[model samples]
Target: MKNHFLWITFLLILSLNACKSIQEKANDQFLSGQYQYAINSYSQILEEDPDNPEANLAIAESYRLSNRIEKAGPYYEKLAEEDPSFETLYRLGLSLKAQEKPEEAKAAFEKAKGFTQEEEYLAETQRQIEAINLAKGIDNYFPNHVLVNYKDLNTPGADYAPVTSENFIYFTSGRQASGLYPADGTPYTKLFRTRAEGIRVDVGSIQSLPEFQNEEGLNQAAIAISPDGNTIIYARGNSTSPKDIPETALFASYFRGAGFTQPIWMPVNEDETWWNSTPAFSPDGSELYFASNRPGGYGGIDLYKATKLANGDFGNAVNLGPNVNTPGNEMFPRPAADGKFFFSSDGHPGYGKLDLFVAENDASGKQVIKNLGENFNSPNDDFGIFFTEYPKTGFISSNREGGVGDDDIYFFEDKTPKPKIVNVLLNVYTKQRVAGEPDAVLEQARVVLYDSANKQTGGDFSNTNGRVRFTLKPDADFTIIASKSGYFSKSIPYTTVGKTPRPEDLVQEVTNITLDTTIVLDQLILEKSIVLENIYYDLDKADIRPDAAKELDKLVQILKDNPSIRIELSSHTDDRSSDQYNQDLSQRRAQSAVDYIVSQGIDPSRLVAKGYGESQLIIKNAQTEEEHQVNRRTEFKVIEIRE
Candidate 1:
């Protein structure tokens, strides 16, 4: 019986040794950065020993190193519940934040602060708290644009970062999941292309690059084409051996006739350990912007800029500074026209994970960053934006739910309506009288503008169409003087007191309010009789009646307006009156009219009154009452000129 017990104990010892051996093997894979293999091995160990710390921790960290930090949330929750530690709780916060549980994440971070007295650690924890609060404030804002998933281009593997050039669309995708990357268990990304119109990509036209440009077991992604469309720069590199540190570098290619030339390693990559990717060119193609994890940055994966040298090589790299870079990773630098640029970041205040942001110069000319709002971003890995049109239309990438793949491409267009504006303008049509009608438009006539203060604001000549325009201020009064050579000058008053539209009425981006008027000017020619209508006198009286005085007032003002000339005021008689009596009465009537003008503050030297007795009439052979009435009329002409 004792011998039998020893045999059973020997079997138990062997099984225990075998379990230890399997666990050590998985540990080696974890330490060596073989996260995918470690995850698999840890999963096997977890089946038998669900409470094992080493196996659970390896699986969680493996997910993190593979850029799948979201997958670690469940594991971290279990581990923290079992035995909470500073590392476990802090990482738990990150996992919860990635899953869009901000309140829970904040609590985890608050607990983590007590585990350490390090200032940097405490400061980081506070930043997380502050970021969560800031994001809450941003949640109230509507999305600047609406994003549409690329249902046609996305696959089960990762696909992202699409750029446009000419008639083609360029992007990267990982379709082959068989040769899984050790760190991620996903196939390495490769450059892909398809026909496109604007932001729309054709599904059936998708094609991969030649084998040379798409090397096996390597990642070729994050392509940026120059504005000229002749050059393209992309990131292409990954470590095959565990002994070598994983590296990504910028590669360039030039287009010739039909296809792009073989990509050459760029010189800007100074070191293999720099870990550069996601390159973009300035709109002018004079500078290159990209993301890197090199030393001397604000923190993890800060953005950098390098000027294109005269020899076509890039100058030394320079960090984008603190306002843009932060403690967390910042990737995908996309520059737009003007001084604005787009990028993605986790360090900035965002909804969750990495959110796209734009850097713009504010009114004070200082750079400020803004979130893209809730629509284009979510609680997932959102990054890699390429703007097809500035601030409006663009391509984006996200790993949010409802996408076809892990990281899918999307197109966005700004749907926010533009602000309303109301512009008030006055258009004037200047013309002169011809015969009895005002049909002759006076081209080249000078139109002078005056403000409410009576100061000359501006002056301009009428166009060939006899049209002149002036911008009018809301609720203001003004006068315009229209004058031309050999023409009588006149002033017209205009007001825009109630012409403005209410704020609510201006619903369009631009609202135009145009007011128009016409002016008629008479030519100042000597001996050009200017008949004055609506004047009358009693039957045969030589005295000027009250009605006659009213007609004379217009002449009084005309003489006042044209002060440089002397006017002849004349009175005529109808043929019905006897010649001798008409002659005698006409002279008296003319003298009476002139006497009235002299009484109204006019210089006597400027008056020249004449009488025509049945000699000057508007109508001859006056038999009817209407004809006789037309025959008896008053007239004046510029008989004398002082100019």
Candidate 2:
């Protein structure tokens, strides 16, 4: 009997030895990233011992990495059921999430909280729970307008990080083919630009910027442009050697004509070892926000802000801390018009893939990070986010299937809820409530303003029947300048102390603005008629100059935003031409003004164009020959007020 017992013990020892060997081999395979092989090895050990937690967990991890998540779920569930721990619960939660059982996943994550004493891990679980809840509520965001399927506008690649300046929209695309052959003979990612016409991407034209291309690198990804379009910043890396330098740096350049000049790398002030990328600038150009994976960071990567020093150098960088960053990888930091920092992260518990999140500094300057939710995120990598300043149409990059390639850019109409009333109406003349007028003159009458720094702050034009309004920005400051020929020029310095007044309170608020009647100052005027010293036309053509168009568009917006005011469009010419000929030429020019406004959706009845010819010449004909040039002009006056 003693000998028989010895034999059984000996057999058990042999079995134990064999199981250890299998577990060791499985672990090695997993570390080497041979997921399928590891799964097979782990299964062999589990066959010998069905309740072996280590072996079961190994199999689950391998299956998870292989994206056979369904197969992973049962194995992880068994391991958790046998011996619940933080690691086991985490794996179980992740597996259930992959299987689309969100409620089960949440329960697993909550169970994980009880298995760990680490505050960091506990906070992380709470964050994940919040992310899941926020994602569940995403369908609630209903935007003002949605442009779902427009042909030219919707490209195939993952396109995002849009920066608009003047008439151009610059963005990054992983779908565009790079001319150079990658190591595997594949096209790398690239950056492309198009016009912002708000249509079927009827992009007047499309062309890749030479400056943004990385001849033999991973590909330039995130990009940001300055307000005036003069400067740009982008992120660049070498994909072939991602770990050689795990992160990317920011580069800046000046726009020289059609191309950008040589780009200059922007490095961290004191630390050159770490990497910096995804640069976003404040509207006033005073502050810069970027992503970095430098040492001392809260986690994988964190958002950092650098203020411009008085000496024209960037200040030392400041990490956003626990509020904005997580233990998971957080990259692609972009600051929106509302001063909120938008970024992408994989560490937070999310629906899937990397999710987009926004971090903002509250009144006390404390940071608050909020997951943007499923509206902007998918079950795939969602990065390179950007939105328009005035109208919230923007784009995001993703590889979430249903796309053209591994990645495709999706232009999304921002469905974020906005304030009840967006802008306030304005009466620029005499600050009185002037309403109702013919369509033509009313359409042409508008106001626009520029700051000393040449930035457009507020103002929009009117529609038909003489009315106008304005979309007041947060704390916008500008010098309001009004223009309409036959009347005098007007200017007003305006400033808003706090956030824009809510839409509900705006109607009852009396925001008054007065405009001067255009006066043909005899001594101030040069010759036969007052000339448009600021209005410039392109060479040998009647088409207004590009700069002139920008100026006029601002005026058009002023009229469109406000309503109910009338004006007379008039044109004058130098005394050199016969009265009859000058009169005819002036009238045609006046009509041109009428046409542009009408094309912009303004009413035709509000405006009336008339040629005064040399009759209203501001300067005497006897002045120097050069003086006569000033007499040729175009003007507008508030001739009639409807209400």
Candidate 3:
């Protein structure tokens, strides 16, 4: 009896200490706005005492804040799995939708409607489910969410650009588990890899890319792995350039074997003042598309393609030409299995910087770029796209405000479309019945184009040519309204065929109308450059921050979009700093920007990073604090480039 009592007392004390420790950690993290950490702390308590309702609720709240809805599923599911409370069921629906399981996600949403007056959330879920259903062209929605996280040492930094092969995923990262190391004392970035263990639903464990590691240079970012997982092509550059030092030309290695053999650079014929990076091998591995800043471009950087010869040498890179190479920058070239090219660009109108876009290669082999619409875009930077080999699920990276750093990865599965979009076209003209050179409406009219339901479709206004072109979703209804300041908006209704057409869905626009040109309006197209009030690092420090990455990404996007645009990345430091130290810091900082741009697939030749240091001080004779602040700055100016 004495021994039993002693053991019970010891257990009680231990439990109390554990609970106290958890509470303290939770409070600390909560006060610090580290909700994820706080929730993790609370989770430990729940693990010990499963009935801790407060802990469960805290986890749910954290999940909501962090947009980790799938994580909230079990807590809510536990409450609703049996009798199903209205709150629990509603949350369950949200959780499932977040998991990208729309059908089951919809069922949970519908079930919640049976108990609560708050049907708004459920209604939204239903609408999304419906939209996904329609978009996928499926009778019943399929649950296709695969968990993909590539782990290993030889893998480069954050194994990203995951290209799925039937049962495996080929990706790039800088981790060393694969035993690859960069030459020189340079910080490491290498393309290490792994294989997925299980079927589509459960993406099991990852096995190291044993064959690819410890090569000559570190194979870091921008990977294009073949669909069969037998081949890989990735970007690599000199470590002396550092992460921010943009190279005049970036090199790529063609990887063979389950593990890579001695990879070779894609010959110097593609080399120009600009760098060649972000190599994407086609599904057949016979073709390659990459970004380059060589001369004869539209403006900044452009995507180019080269054919693989039977001798394993690449043919001269053919310029993708005007259709695909805009005056703006284009990078992250991904050739989808369906023959469409998916890439990230800033030249096209999108939600924000570096939006992901898809383009179809016409029968004539011309590239036509189209935005993926709003679902996959946000107001912040989005890039680094790759899909899982499992047919639909995969990941992407973005620094769009809500992530932990400059770039955060997101996993999404294909929301199959029900009815497909066959084709779509919109025309803008001065509203008048006059047949030839009709001139009744306002000139330079600003037209805001929208999709079928009035959501913004990515398109531009009537150019001097007075025309706007767009690709349409199949089997979808589209409405277009054209307006000037004074004229009543003209609404045009059109529908596209879902399946093989009965020939009824196609329509031609001959309808004409006269518009009132009386309403005068001022339209301003804002093309704003990011302004740095002041750029300063700690004394003698050269490390780049996540915030700097955001700004650099914007600059990079601009360069990629405008193929002919060239700019010098200038770095400056405060006059108070020693001249030599300031100069070195400035140079490193400028180089850092260049390095990041090169990593993002921008051709380095287009950019020149210079360390101005205190040489270009904005304020002369810095006696006051405010004037001294002016000496620290970084700026860019466009240089000569081809049209």
Candidate 4:
């Protein structure tokens, strides 16, 4: 009986040792990033030791790190139920959020907040909570625009991140070449191309680049072609050899007529230990952008830009600064020609995971970041966006649910009813001399448009219709000056303020509206008497009346506009008054008018006060009161125009 008991105990000891060996193997697999292998091993242990905390957390982290975040949610939830620490709770929230379970995600984030007093941790938790709220109302954005899968370009494997250059579309796809990458369990991707007409991709013409860089089991993806399409920059790596530290570096390959030349290692990749990929060029090809997790970054995997030197090689990389880099990963930089900078971010408050964000400059020139919102963003991984066309037409990448497979390429267009187009056309008609007579077209007159700052924005000569047209900027102030050799220059203030059509008021694709104004320049005719209209005074008074002062203001503007002209502001009296008395009274009235004109900031030397009195009367012997009254008047004539 004693011998039998010892045999059973001996077998139990052997079984215990075997279990320890299995645990060590599973740990090794997880540490080596063989996540699927780790998951399988962990599952076997969980069948016997179902409550093993180490096994559960390892399996959950393995799933999350492997891009199986959807599968990680249940494990994270179970771990959090057992022990709701900050890390577990925060990770759980991330999984739930990526899966589009906003309510549950928010609840998890709220729970995470209670688990820590560290500002960074608490802030991250709060960010997740705010992102949940952001997702809740996402449907209100880009109302009519819904993202459509590029059904022809997509495959059962992943196909994403397409960019257009001329009539060709370049992209990354996992279906055609290379072996599986254990990281996401997807086939290694290669750079591919096809013919494109604007946003439409010609799927049948899709062709992968020759294997001049990555080997059979390696990967090459995320490309940037120059505006001339002569150069292509891409990421190539994934050395599976256990002896080498895993590294992905950038390579530059040139178009050698029919195909790409073999890639050469880029010098801008300063560190081999850091992960660097996702190359993009500025619309003008002056700078190159990529994502890197090198030291001195704001956080994990921050975006960086390197300037293209005159030698055509990239210079030192620069961080996009605090406004763009968050404490979370930001990648896939795409700067458009429309002055908008786009990239994917998990740092900025977003719907979930990596959301598309556009960085814009406001009126103050401050950088403002905004989510692409709703249709362009989802709760899953969305990154690597490229413009197939400008003004909101593009191909986007997302791993959102209901895709044909993992990470599909989606075609998007801004279909918000073409928006409201208000074309504010300013038609400036230059007419003939003073009093705007003849109404004949005046050609060859120089017309200049200046902003409120007196800076000339545009200048053009009057056409056959004496018309100079310009498209006015909205909510602006401008001054239009028209001048000719024999004519006095005239400055007119034109304000576009309160003149624009509201966005909601325009239902048509384009609303054409014209603002017509006539600029009549006076010919510099010396001694040509031009009567001033509506110049009147209280009966028998020498003091300038308010009405008379108002008329004199026009003379002030003319003097100001034609800086070289000296005008004679003269007044005459009726024949009834004694010649000397009328002369004295008229002289005082004319002087008073000159004084008012001087007060309006016109140069004093530009005026001459003259009084003709009864000597200048039209009716030699006025009998009727109307004829006598007509003899009292005020007039101005250009006496001298100084050079």
The best candidate by lDDT is: 1
Return model 1's CA RMSD, one decimal. 12.0
* Tens-place lDDT digits, model 3, residues 1-643: 0011121122222334557878676655544435667776877988897765556656665665443556787877766755566666766765765555657766876787677554444454454445434434322212433323222212223335555555565555444533322221123445434455332323245444554554434335676655455555666653333443344344444454444565555573355335677777776878878887777776467888888788766677888776666655688887776877788875564543466777787679877666665556555556667765433666766655445433445666665534323343435553332335534444554555466667977645555554555555655766554544323334445555443344454343222222212222222112212244344456576666777777776666556535666677788777887888888889998887778788999888888888988887778778988776667766776654555
Taking all chains together, the TM-score of candidate 3 against the true structure is: 0.37
lDDT of 1 by residue, 1-643 (tens): 0011121122122232337777777776666667888888878888898876656776887787677877898777777788777677777888889888999999999998887787777788899889999997664123667899988789988999999888788998997533666777778888888888878778897888542357777778999888898788999876576554458899898877887889887888878778889999998998999998887887778899999888877778899999999988899998877777889999999988899888898899999888878887898988998877766787899999999978999998888866576667789989998986647888999998899999997789999999999887777889888888798778778888889888777767787899998878888898888878887888778777888889888788777767787888888889987887877777778888899999997898998878888887678887899898887888888878786
Say which prediction, candidate 1 or candidate 2, comes out ahead on lDDT: 1
- CA lDDT of each candidate? 0.82, 0.62, 0.58, 0.80
Comparison by TM-score, 1 against 3, better one: 1
TM-score of each: 0.68, 0.49, 0.37, 0.68
Model 4 Cα lDDT, one tens digit per residue, 166-275: 68888878876657776656787877888888788788888775435445677777888888888889887876786543788888987777877888878788877778
For model 1, the local distance difference test gives: 0.82
Q: Model 3 segments beyond 4 Å from truth? A: 1-159, 174-188, 197-208, 214-219, 227-230, 241-259, 361-367, 389-391, 416-643
Clashing pairs in 4: none
**What's the CA error at residue 135 for candidate 1, in Å?**
1.4
Clashes of each: 0, 58, 62, 0
After superposition, which runs of candidate 1 have C-alpha atoms over 4 Å from their true positions? 1-18, 139-144, 176-178, 210-212, 239-245, 254-261, 416-643
Top-down lDDT ranking:
1, 4, 2, 3
Q: Model 4: number of clashes? A: 0
